[model samples]
Target: MKKAKLLAALGICGLILGACGAEDDSKYDTSTTEVSESEAVVKEPGLDELDPAVSEELSKMGTDEEIDWEKINFNKRQYKEYIESLDEQETDSSETGESTLTVVSSSMVDDNTIEIVINNTDASEMSELTNGFFAIMMDTFSRQLYLNSDYSDGTNQPTIIIKDNAGTVISEETDFIEMEETE
Candidate 1:
């Protein structure tokens, strides 16, 4: 019951943030600057190594505009309080076996990308837990960005990356990695 409610709340928050993005489209500069042929070459992220489906998904989520990272704050007082409440609710944890998650830190790789590092005691169970919560985290983070920043240009969609304690990547929630152009 609690899980269902939490998911619903997160979904609502995502919708609110999506609305927020639409309002700030004017903040982005629309001026076109001419660049030389050499300067116009854009470097892409190494995503060809991933499976075709995964690569395709990431591309759809990628935004060309850079995000203004200075204004994003997910650990503000209200959100911190909310996070604390979530911790308290975990006393009635649904899982039976040992499944613990400790968030190490979260930071921006770029404007639209938020990487959340966590230490899960059960490495074997990491995939299951990550898969379960990835959507929620993505929505929550994206919503938080809109709530905290006035610079949302609709390109503020967050791509969440989850990595385990041993520096192993557990899961990625976005399909926006840059792919090489096939000749």
Candidate 2:
């Protein structure tokens, strides 16, 4: 009878141990699935150059004064240097355009990408107008360009430009304005 009881207790302990082992395996399987899925979705850029025209445009849209430009972390020095050089070039190029108005600001999104905002004028209805203008320009360039007007401050006004390694505008330029503001 004692032997029978010992045998029954051992069976119960074996069942519990088996269930615990199965639970551990399930956790490891779930973690592996998540890692593999993430690896599949994250696409890296193929090119490492920036278009001079786009760089010039971004430069004119100065860095957000309230946000520090030097401290923000960037994935690549080439990307940051391109943005800085563009801003300096835009400032120098402004005198060349009598009717064209450009405001520039830049922020780092991660190690790989930078967000550039450009605004043309101060009118309340300028957001859509500017965006449409940029969209056409991006289409003409045959690149994917993104337009993000909602990202701007009330005073600074925002128009976002996104570019990939081919220096192709991956986002639509929905934030460009061609009309001159009236006095």
Q: Which number leads on TM-score?
A: 1
**Which pairs, if any, clash in model 1?**
57-175, 58-175, 58-176
Q: Please list the C-alpha lDDT of all candidates, in the order they appear.
A: 0.52, 0.42
How do the residues 1-183 of candidate 1 rate in per-residue lDDT, one tens digit apiece? Answer: 999999999999999999988887788876767778987855433322334543343344337744444433333333333333332332212276476565666555565555656655555745555534643554454454445543245554456666755767665655433334998
The C-alpha stretches of model 2 lying farther than 4 A from their native spots are: 1-75, 91-98, 122-127, 135-183
lDDT of 2 by residue, 60-177 (tens): 4334433222332222344334444433333222354533434254554543234545444434475455545554453322111211111223243233354432344535333443
Clashes of 1: 3
Q: What is the TM-score of each candidate against the true structure?
A: 0.35, 0.27
Q: What is the C-alpha RMSD, rounded to one decimal, of candidate 1? A: 21.6
Candidate with maximal lDDT: 1
